[model samples]
Target chain A: MIRTLPCSAAYTNGFRLYMVLFYIFLIMPLVTICILAFNDSNYIALPWNGFSLDWFFANTNERLGLFKDEGLMLSVWTSLETGFFVALFSTIIGTIAALLFEEEQFRMKGFLYFLALAPLVIPGVVLGISILLSSTYAGTYLEENLGMSFEFLGPSFWLVVIGQFSFGATYVMLLVGARLKKFDRVLEEAALSLRATRLEVIWLITIPFLRPAIIGAFIVAFLISFSNFNTTIFLVGSDPTLPVDLYSRIKFSSTPVLNAVSFMIVVFISFAAMISYVINRKKT
Target chain B: MKKNKSSTFFLLMVPVLLWLVLLIVIPHLDMFFRSFRFENDEGLMVFSLNNYLSFFEDKIYWLTFVKTALYSIGVTILAFIVTFPVAFFLTKVVAKKYSSFMVLLLLIPIWIGELVTIYGWMILLSDNGVINNFLMQIGLIDSPIVMLYTNFSMTIGLLYMSMLFMIIPMMSALESLDDSLIEAASDLGASKWTIFRQIIIPYTTPGIASGGIIVFMLVIGDYVAPNILGGKSSLWFTEQIYNKFLATFNWNEGAAFGFLLLLLSSGIIWLALKLTGQKLEKVGS
Candidate 1:
């Protein structure tokens, strides 16, 4: 018989045990938060009271649940709105950029590509500050020189979208670009040779080829914009995204409702992830 | 036809080029200019190096900057050591079908909101937190150990935050290795350690480099874990930048510090690339 490998049965069993423990360490925190969310204890920690939904549904003078908390709900609404606008704008511009980069010959293409990728490498905090300062300066110039003012131009809802879209677009471009790399350009040329106009070829062949990537990029961008905190924190004006609101609430005065909100978000994201995993698993 | 194609390319490029210019390039340029100027007594903007000089003059600023860089580097190495085995185990030991499930399990924490993840850690590691309470109930100690607000807690949180970034790349790298190569080495009478060192480590260098770069950059630039878990003991560089901009309203100082951070991170990335001999394009993708 062939010699057994260096790792004995005991060694393999030990390694397997270690892997299980490591996975537990990776998952324990989120599991704890989920459990504590429904705990009847007013405090967020252990010593869980009887199972109750007060954190999710209760509204009283002392304890306000996630559903009844107006400020928290409003922030959630703002985050969804920001995610929508950022996702839409980033998807369009990023897809264009991806298609443009596929062209064989172009001037300054390398430099432009580098610039496009710069946002990915830069720290989000710095990106936020730079965007905020530049927009502030632009707003001042318009007010002083042109005798005009636009409320949307400042640090408001639109600015948050712009700030998030700055990097979100980069992500979309990368995703779409990866997809385009695998595309068969011969299909486009074949369509064009068949008396199909360029626009017709693109609409029929190219866009359909890119549909999966575009949809994937949109969802990815939306999730990123919704969860973004470092960049949006600086750019948010009167209204905060869910993350920023949760951050401030945690910093100052927090309740178990915060845990409830976290629980809801975790469940939603996990469900979305499971769906995407199923879809991708099916495709593969 | 060539001319038409070139013109069409230009038209397609314009929107994205404009977006990058108006938002990214121009804003960074604005920041660069802002970093170099200060308002005078006469309310006139004057170009000076004082903003940069202040960074040099203050011992705390530079010290904290160096400490943050070192701490992040330490975390990067620690994360690599911790995750490499997990990555290896997943790719080498587990069945193929279950590996994806394992990856998805690890990914849940990453895709969850960062703030919520941190809050989870806060509950676990705080003074009267889960671990402490459990330990006390077991008669390990009479009082809760000061787990939170220490450098230990900050590093733990940072490592947790960085787990997925480190693990994903390592898994991908290890997955690409040919199993037969290891089998061949084993058949040649090589010990497992020798095969791992001679073949696996050398082969996965690119993945290691990329993962290391991503993890180091993230840990260094992060403001959340350091602030929430680090408390007063951890003087993270991003916290300094935040204070300068938001607390002091000193945009000039903040801009200078921000550029410095950018420079430090980029410099380290360049060194990593050089040392690993991996192209930016290959590692980035």
Candidate 2:
């Protein structure tokens, strides 16, 4: 919370020093990388040689190599696809969960809210391993007795999405729940009294009102899925997500190209975030 | 109108509630069940305390739990130190014009993935890395410092990864506070430190506790930062759980480890809620 005490100009100036150090510590490394993206040398560190675009443009074949690396590209696509589905599913589901819990007459509201939010508290790594163990156990049981072979029963892309879906949806629930606390039910009642069908009222009235929050929840879920490494690492199929792919590279043979990749990722994400922020701003 | 409304609401809720029960509630029960099954010639399914006991019986396994808790607390404190002042300046101290840009700068790190953040720290903290080379060139040290793959680096990694999580809630809370309260305190003759101690800290305690707890929870359960940055010495409980499921295929032991973390975090949260009664939800508005 803001300090509610009046301070002399000098004391305020003194506090400014800490803010400067915080910025320096947090921002300097990123600036270093941004600058090093233009490095002419093989290394991705300081003492820059002449400024050059060769590292950026001459890396076309390497980019193709990264694509030809089937596992990496596959995982990247899988992550993108998973992120989209998770975002879409979680936004719709979580919003509904939020609205359900927001109403006055729901019984065991606190406990239901707790259940909805518990996955967010649980760690991703633990969640991932738990999902894997349980799924494999079920898969084995089905194969032995039930006379069934199930692709979805093991650690595949589907299981990964399910694992992600469990907690990612919880995040969406909490976010939408928070926003729903202030939702005015009177508007719905007003629309309904005018003889609008329930479906018509929800479609023409409620969805538009909740649009910003639904979008916000989707963006958050998408970001979580895209960048998720801990859970995805264990549950990954023959392919891994982008984070997992990068992890293997860093562990094995790291080139400055990884830095190049990171730089490109920053560009892509920054543009997306800016667009989302602008939309969010306009909405508010 | 009411009858139709209830029906439509139920219709809207069907997929979400069904999904939650099938995926979350059931899987949680499965996690608890997996923790109890024992390993033997029969291959799984014997109720036992051996899984929990093994955490202590095997030094490496439970020790990681202790190490992870300590690491989480350490990183939480470090992040609070870095973020609180920045948030305070943004909310209370800085002029309105500059704070937005500074806040954006603070948020930029978040655009980078957590794994990428770890890599960024790894590059800076490597032996011939950015920070080491910079120090050496100024003749600060004759030899480049060995900074990689240590507990120190692990703390740094967690702090960097956790900063945004800590900052967002804290700033939001701080923004809601009335700036005039601080002016009143000063006008009534309280010193800056006195106002901070008596009013500011008390007002912000919820933010500190919530942000701190969230950071601790995320840090304690993290596997990537330790795996990449802690290289050798970073023994985290989540890693232990990872090994149990994947490496050794000991689901029971891993499940036990997961439950242990759950207990640890739950206990901390219980204490936090115990101390901060109605205080946290008040800060939201």
- For residues B1-285, what per-residue lDDT tens digits would candidate 1 score against the true structure? 375564456667779878999999999998988999888889888998999999999999999999998999999999988888888888888778998888888878877867888889899987777888889899999988998888998998899987678887787888888887887888889887898789989999988988988888788888888988887868899999999987999998899999899889889888998988986666556
| Docking category of candidate 1 | medium
Model 1 off-target regions past 4 Å?
Answer: A1-6, B4-7
* TM-score leader: 1
Give per-residue CA lDDT, model 1, range A51-138, as digits (tens).
9899888899888989999999999999999999999999999888888877456778888888888776688888989998899889
Q: What is the DockQ of each candidate?
A: 0.53, 0.48
- TM-score of each model, in listed order: 0.96, 0.91
Clashes of each: 0, 4
CA lDDT, candidate 2, residue B139: 86
lDDT of 2: 0.75
Candidate maximizing lDDT: 1
